[model samples]
Target: MRNGKGQERKASPSFFTGEKWLVLTGLLGFLLAAICGVWVILYGGPVFPKGDVLKAFSFNAALGVFLLSTAAILPFTALGNKSRALFRWSYIVLALYSYAAETVQNFRGVDPRFVKGGMPFDVWVGSIFTFVALLLILFYLFVAVQYFRPKAYRLRPELIVGIRYAMLAVLLSFAAGVWISFNNGRLVGLHGSIIWLHGLGFHALQVVPFIAWLSERTALTHSARKAFIHLAGTAYLVSLVAVGWQTYLGHPVLEWSVLPVLAFVSLLISLAPGIVLLRRQSDQTVPAGKAIL
Candidate 1:
């Protein structure tokens, strides 16, 4: 390939390795944890008086899903062969840290995030967990930086747009995480739960990309695809903002009001592409669009 001078040019590298292990492990963890959560919910009581372990497996299931979602997006990032080994090992360690931080700590009846304990729990486990979490945020920040590079121009327009917006939400989640660490609780204003906002921010990684993914499989004009991407991206961010606003105000996020209603409606709008895709799939009416890379 050449530029104005028509000289040969080597393509930039952005391939990700070890995504398969992350996907397989995460899926297995989710299924196993889900089964355990259900069984515990049916037949067990809280291991701790605070009832932390009672629902521990359920949250572990969610953590597993988080890993899977992260795996899904890593291939699209600008990671190169030179950095692949380090990133892959770091991800594995992070996965283990996440699993232990939630599951084992809960089983031991210790609060993973904000524990009041000593010895192995405090100096060892707690400090390491915080460091690991920071490492994850920093890792994603590196991905964000790579996405802005010219190599990212190789991405499809809508995919890149979705990735950018999704990264914003992720960064916002990191910010909320920092706030939680400082506050030592999920509670914010009044009854508002910062954790809820945090979850939404992270889940945007999956939701926004899903729309772009579906659009490639459905019959849509170029304008239509771009429009859907913008709509979903903007709507999702708006919903996040609305929730953040209400969260900061210390009110229930779903409290019946203009902001909450707007948030709910925007979320629905963001997911509308999926509904359309499903209906078309059922009716056998969706024409194939461009092949997804």
Candidate 2:
């Protein structure tokens, strides 16, 4: 592709070829997870009593898809060849083990919770899964830092910034997940919460970049586009924090509360400057006789 200066820019080497297996497997896993999610929504009953077969299938499927997808995209960052190979193998092995462990625990009606007398097989396996998953979080954190480094792999600034924010969110979510696991899935007041925040945070990896990409296609100036990205990321983080605060207060995510309302209002307030800047940028781009709609 040619830049504005008419110079041709060579595309970065595609990670897809090297990671084809991961991509394919990840896509398959995601499809399976989607099917399972639908199945559980339609046929399954309550989500509790943890050993339900459909629930297990759905949960494991979702986890597998997430791990596989993470593995697939991780090499796109600035890892050296050796590091990339090691991460790839480790991720694949851990993902496979995690799926197997989940299946065994679910089928055998094992609870992930540890008992005073002895830990069940499921708890042991689940602990292993948690450990491996947390290790992967370190890799994500590394990638997040790499995004800001001088020699980092080239991408649009929006994508780099988005990924960095998303990884931060993922790290926070994983840390919270570890805490909840140790506390037997809930703190005294919080009950079995934190899931909402964790889910929202982790998915920011997709959501922020997608929004940034869409915004890049608009007629905004580079600075205005960046303003939009920063605004969106800040709003996203604030929303997560608000939900997390709610959960910490031992409230359901959707429960009417001052925190959430304030959070959204804060997001809108934070976005106003960006909106104004974007409007000015748009106006500047218009022709003398033409009006901006």
Candidate 3:
């Protein structure tokens, strides 16, 4: 990790870094996503499609990017540090099984959960896949619970807060996954799918945190930055609830009228704080974060 000159050398990103096998596994997820997405495209215009690979690959790609991106920050979280080796390793292995199940079985045109006929894929493989998926959810829930307290996980002030909220959202995502499983499908009715709520829940990993990073770039006070984080986080959470309610009512959130309005309005609320902060700083000659940039 160093040169002959003895200057502090950066650790190169690789398999050894923070158990980055997760990132490698995540890339495989994206590859599966691309494959399934392309398959759906070629299959033509059916919204639901013949097979359920749309949700399969969608889950892979979304969780892929999330797991991949969040791996870098694992070292920063106290629960993810070397002190908690067993928990860390267990999560990685379980996650591998869960993701691998999706990638392999989905590509084979088999439902990893619902396979029948008492074949090996159904009795053993599918059962194991279901168990692993549940285990992975518990693992993520453990993390979310641990990381919700900043004292438990260390990071920059605003970012730590964002992480707390994001992980909480991920916990909800896992909950939503369970809901979908019990319901046997994402569709709530004629047009709505809980998939809307499920998919976007994972996205909180980026949404509010990205806003935190953006807020850090302004000439705002530290307290001001933190306040903006809260505002944005609340708005984002509200948007999720609005969308969830819309989906549960068997109406697509994006459909015209109140359904779309409620979700979009919540999103707009998150933007207001950032906009106000940026506008207030516009008169200043140099932004506070210019040096860091």
Give one clash count per candidate, in the order shown: 1, 0, 0
Candidate 1 lDDT tens digits, 1-293: 33223434344323224577777767766775876677577867466633365556766676677777877767666667567556666777786777767667666667676667544644577778888889988976877776566656354445666777788887888888887899888888678888777889888888887777666555566567668777888888888888888888888886898878988998899888767655654443343333322
Look at candidate 3 and give me any clashing residue pairs: none
Which regions of candidate 3 deviate over 4 angstroms?
1-19, 37-55, 116-120, 150-154, 271-293
lDDT of 3 by residue, 1-293 (tens): 33223444333222125655666766877887888788778873233212366767676788678777567545445564554466567766776776777656665666776666545754687888778878878766666666566454223445667667777677777777888888877788887888778878888877776666667566666666778888888887888888888888888777777857978988888778756755665545333222121
Q: What does the lDDT read for residue 60 in candidate 1?
A: 66
Give the least accurate 10-residue stretch of model 2, judged by summed lDDT.
284-293
Ranking by TM-score: 1, 3, 2
TM-score for predicted model 1 compared with the true structure: 0.83
Q: Estimate each model's TM-score.
A: 0.83, 0.75, 0.78
The number of the candidate with the highest lDDT is 1
